[model samples]
Target chain A: MEKKIAHFTIDNKECTATTGVSIINAARENGIFIPTLCHYEGVKPAGSCRVCTVKVNKRHLTACTTPVAEGMEIEVDTAELNDLRSSVIELLFTEGNHYCPACEKSGNCELQALAYRFGIMAPRFPYQFNERDVDASHPKIYHDHNRCILCKRCIRIIKDEKDLPAGSQGRSIFAFNQRAKKVKIKLDDRLGKELSDELAQKAMDICPVGSILVKETGFKTPIGQRKFDKEAISLDNSINLKAMKEAHHE
Target chain B: MSKPVIATTSLAGCFGCHMSFLDIDERILDLIELVEFNKSPIDDIKSFTKDCDIGLIEGGCCNTENIHILKEFRKKCKILVSFGECAIMGGLPAMRNDIPVKECLAEAYLSGPSTVNEEGILPNDEELPIILDKVYPCHEIVKMDYHLPGCPPRADLIWEVLHALILDVDIDLPYELIKYD
Candidate 1:
C-alpha cells in the first residue's frame, strides 16, 4: 500500500511528510531542526521533556509525539519558542546539581551543548541545589542523580534482563521507574556485572547528560578532542553543515 | 575623559579566573592601555578608593567576608560581572552545599584524615570570617549585571567581554569562546 503524504507549513516554509510521521522526524527530513532532549531515534517518544514544544494549528504541542496531518500549520522556530526553550534549559540547570567541571561527560554532554548554543552564561532561575544520591553499586555503570534531567532516555533504551532466560543474548541490564514525583534508574546487579564493555559504553552514550557514566574510563579524551567540543549536536545534516561552516570560520 | 576604571576581586575562588584573564597573552598591553586598574589584586589595592566603571568578581559567597566585599563592589561599581564558574554558580565550593556545616567543620578540623587537632576544637576566633551555611552564587545575594561561565572563563571570552564593555559596543560571543567547564 502506498503511504499517504501530508503537506504542511512550518515556520512559513512548506514541507511534505508522510501521514503518520512525527513532526520532529518530518522536520528533520526536511532540514528543519527541532531541539529535543528526550526523543531519541527509534525509541517511542515519551514527551517528558517539553523542549520540542511547537505550535500546531494555533495550539502548543510536543513535536515528537504529535503526528503530522494534512495542511497542518506548525510554528517551530520563533523568538517566543526560543525563550521557552532557554527557560527549560535553565530550569534543568537549577533543578539539579550539574557541576560540569567535575562531570565525566563534561565536554560531550548534550545539555551543556544546548546551553552553549543558546549562549546561556548562567541560569536565571534560583539554584535549588537539591541533595541527590550517586549509585555506583553496579560493577560497570554509575548513575549520578545530580546531573539527571529526568529525560528517561536510559529507561526507554535499556531493558530489564530479569525475565529473560539465563544466558540469553541481547537481554537488558537496566531498569528504571518513576514514583511520587521521583524517578530512578537501576541496574540489574547480576546482569549488569556481565555486561560487555561495548554495551556499557553504549549506555553511557545513551545518556544525554552526565547522569550515567561508565566507571574507570573518564577524562580519557583531552579537552580539545571531546565530541561536542569541536562540533555542536546536529539534529539534521543541514545543521551539521552550518556548524561546520562556523567551525571553519573560527 | 579618564580611562574606564576597573576593579576586581576573588571571594571564594581559586584565582584560576584571574590567571585566565592574564592568559590573554600580549594583549595585556592593550588592556593596560584601554583601562585603569583601581582595586585589583594585580595592582595590590586592598580596597576600593573610588567609584569604578566595572567590577569583575571571581568566586561565590562562602563566608561573611565574601558577602561584605561583594556588597561593597555592588555599591562602588556601576557594572559587576561574575567572572567565572565559581562566581556564577559557587563552582567546586558548592560541593559542600549538600553536607551540613557541622559535618564540614568536623571533617575539616577534628575528624578528617589529615586532622592533627588533639583538642577536637573548632576554630572560633573573632578575626576569622564566619562560614555561611552554604556557598551561594553572587547573583543570589546581590544583583549581578553579567556572568561569564567557565572553570576559569576562557581567556578569549574574558577579553571579548572586557573589550566590548570598554568600547561600549555590543558583544558578539563566538561559539568557541563559550564553555561551562
Candidate 2:
C-alpha cells in the first residue's frame, strides 16, 4: 500500500511528509534541524525532555512524538520557544550536579552543547545540588546518576534479542529493567560480563549527557581537539545542510 | 570620562579564575587602556579605595570573610559579576554541601589522612573567620548582575565582557567564548 503523504508548514516553510512520521524526523528529512536531547535515531521517541517542544496549531507539543498531519501549521524557532528551551536546559543543569570542568564528557556533552547554543551564562533557578550516586558495578560501563538527564536512551535502545535465531539475525541481546518513579538502566549480570565492546560503546554514544562512560579510558582527546570545541554542534549540521544545498544547485 | 574602575577578588575558590583572567596575556595592556584596576590582586590593592564601576567576583561564600567582602563589593561596585563556576553555582567547594559541617570538620582536621593533631584540635581562633554551614553561590548572598560560568571562566569571555562593559557596547558572546570548562 502506498503511504499517505501529508503536507505541512513549519516555521512558514512548506514541508511534505508521510502521515505517520513524527514531526522531528519529518523536519530533519526537510533539513530543518529541531534541537533535541532525548530523541535518538532509530529509537522510539519518549518525549521525556521538552527541549524539542514546538507550537502545533498554537498549542505546545513535543515535536519528537507529535505526528505530522495534513495542513498542520508548526512553529519551531520562535523567540518564545527558544526562551522556553533555554529554561529547560538551565533547569537540567541546576537539577543535576553537572561539574563540566571535571566531567569526562566536558567537550562533547549534548547538554553543554545545548547550553552553548542557548547562550546560557547562568541558570536563573537556584542550584539543587542533589547528591546522586554513581554505579560502577558493570565492568565496562559506569553510570553516573548525577549527569543523567533521565533521557532513557539507554533504557530504550539496548534490548534483548535472545529469542531470535543465532547468527546475523541475533545481534541485539540486552534488556533494561526499570520501574516507574525510579528508572535505572539495568543489564543482566551474565550478559553484562559477556557484553561486547561494541555494545558498551553504543550505550555511551546513545547517552546525550556524560551519564554513561566507558571505564579504563577517558580524556583521550585533548581540549582543542574535542568535539564541540572548534565548532558548535548545530554549526556542523547547518554546514552539512549548506553543502547539500550547494550540491543540489550544482 | 575616566576609565571604568574594576575590582576583583577570590573568595572560597582556588584562585584559578584569577589565573584564567591572567591568561588574557598581552590583552592586559589593552584592558589597562580600557579600565582601571581597583582593590584587585592585579595591583595588590588591599581594599576598595573608591566606588567602582565593575566588580569581578570569583568563588562562592564559604566563610564569614567571603560574605563580608561580597557585601562590601555589593555596596562599592555599581555592577557585580560572578566570574566563574564557583561564584555562579558553588563549584567544587559545593561538594561538601552533601555532608554535614561536623563531618567535614572531622574529615579535615581530626580523622583525615593528613591530620597529625593528637589533641584532636580544630582551629577555633577568635581572629579566624567563622565557616558557613555550607558554601553558597555569590548570587545567593548578593544580587549578581552577570555570570561567566566555567571552572575558571575562559579568558576570552572575561576579556569580551570587560571590553563590552568598558566600551558601553552590547556583548555578543560567541559559542567558543562561552564554555563551562
Candidate 3:
C-alpha cells in the first residue's frame, strides 16, 4: 500500500512528506536546518535533547519525534526558536564537564559544533563541574561519564547482532545505572568483552560527545583538519561552502 | 586623541594565548598604531600607570593572587575580555576541580611518580599565593565584557576582535574563526 502524503508549510515554505515521517526529517528533505544532538540517524528518536524543537500553532514540539500532519504549519527559523535552541546547548555545556580544550573529541564533537553554530561565547548558566567517573575496564572502549549527556545513542545503537548463535537480536551491551544526576552508562561485562574493534569504533562514533572513546585512538586528526573544524555545522553544505569562501576572501 | 591603552596578563595559563596574539605578526605594527600597552607582560610593566581601555585576561583563577590580579583588571580596565578557553571556562587547570584541594597538593608534592623530597614537605612560603579551593573561570570572579573561546583562540580571531574594538566597529566574527578547541 502506498503511504499517505502529508503537506506542510515550514517557515511559510511549502513542503510535502510521507505521513509519519518526522518533522525534522521532513525539514531536512525540504532543505531547512533544525539542529539536533540526541536525535541520530537510523536510531529511535528519544526527544531527550530538545534541541530540534519547533513551534506548531503555538505548541512547542520536538521535530525529531513529532510526525508530520497534513497541512501542518511548522514555525522554524524564528529568532525565538533559535534562542531557545542555543539555550538548550548552553544548558548542556554547563551541566556537564565539557572541557573542550582537553577533550580527545574536541574538534569533532557535535555538542561543541552546535555551540560554534550558535556562537555561544560562554554558557549563560554557571558551570556545574559535576564530578563524574571514567569507566575503563573494557579493553575495547572506555566510557567517560563526565562527558555523557544521557542521550542513550550507544545504548540504542550498539546492540547484539542477530544471526549469531547467541541469537539475541537486540540485546543491549550498555545499560543505565543509578538515577537522576548520579545516572551513568554501565557496560555489560559479558557482551562488552566480546566487542570487536569495528564495533568499538562504532560505539565511539555513535556517541555525540567525548563520552565513549576507543582505547588508544585519541587525537588521530590534527587541529584544523578534524570534522567541524574547517566547516560549519549545517544541514546545507552549499550554504556553508559559500560562507567558507566569503570568510577565506576576507 | 590618545590611543586606547590595553593590558594583558596570564594567570594560570600556558601562555599559548599570548603566543597566538603575537601570531598576528606584522599586524602588531598596525595594532600599536591604534592602542598602547599598559601593565602587560608584553611590555613588562609592573603596575598600571593609568586606567586601561581594554584588558585581555589569558587564564582562569587557581590561586588567591589570580583573584587579586583579576579584581585589579576589573577596577582599572573599561572592558575586560576573557581571551582563551581557560579564562572563559577554567580549561585544563580545572580538571582537578573534582578532587579535593588537599588531595591535589598531596599528589603533586607527595604521591606523584617523580618525587625527590624524602622529607615529604609541601611548599608553604609566605610569599607563595594560596591555591583556591577550585579553579574558576575569570568571569566567575569578575564581570567579563567579552569572551574569545578556543584552546588558544585563533590568532585571526584575536586580531579581528582587537581590530573591531579599536576602530569602534561591530565585531563580525566569521564562521570559520569560531572554534572551541
lDDT per residue for candidate 2 within B1-181, as digits (tens), equals 7889999999989999999999999999988888889999889999989999999999999999999999999999999999998898898898888678999999999999988999988999999999898899999889999999877888988898888888789967877777888
Worst 10 residues of 3 chain B by lDDT: B171-180
Off by over 4 Å in 1: A160-172, A236-250
- Comparison by TM-score, 1 against 2, better one: 1
Interface alpha-carbon RMSD, every candidate: 0.9, 1.1, 1.0
Q: After superposing candidate 2, which stretches have Cα over 4 Å from the reference?
A: A162-184, A235-250
Q: Order candidates by TM-score, high to low.
A: 3, 1, 2
- How well docked is model 1, in DockQ terms? 0.76
Predicted structure 2, TM vs. truth? 0.92
lDDT of 2 by residue, A1-250 (tens): 8999999999999989899889987898887878888877565688999999999999999998999999999999999999999999999998888988889989888888889888898898988877777889888888888888888777676655565666533433344456654555556676677777887887787678898899988998998787788677673443224434655686
**How would you encode candidate 3's per-residue C-alpha lDDT over B1-181 as one tens digit per residue?**
9999999999989999999999999999999888999998899998999999999999999999999999999999999999999999899999999999999999899999996779999999999999999999998999999999988899999999998888889877888788887
lDDT for model 3 comes to 0.88
The number of the candidate with the highest DockQ is: 2
Second chain TM-score, each model? 0.98, 0.97, 0.98
lDDT of 3 at A39: 81
Off by over 4 Å in 3: A162-169, A236-250
Fraction of native contacts (fnat) of each candidate: 0.69, 0.81, 0.86
Ordered from best to worst DockQ, the candidate numbers read 2, 1, 3
Kindly report the root-mean-square deviation of model 1 from the true structure over all alpha carbons: 4.6
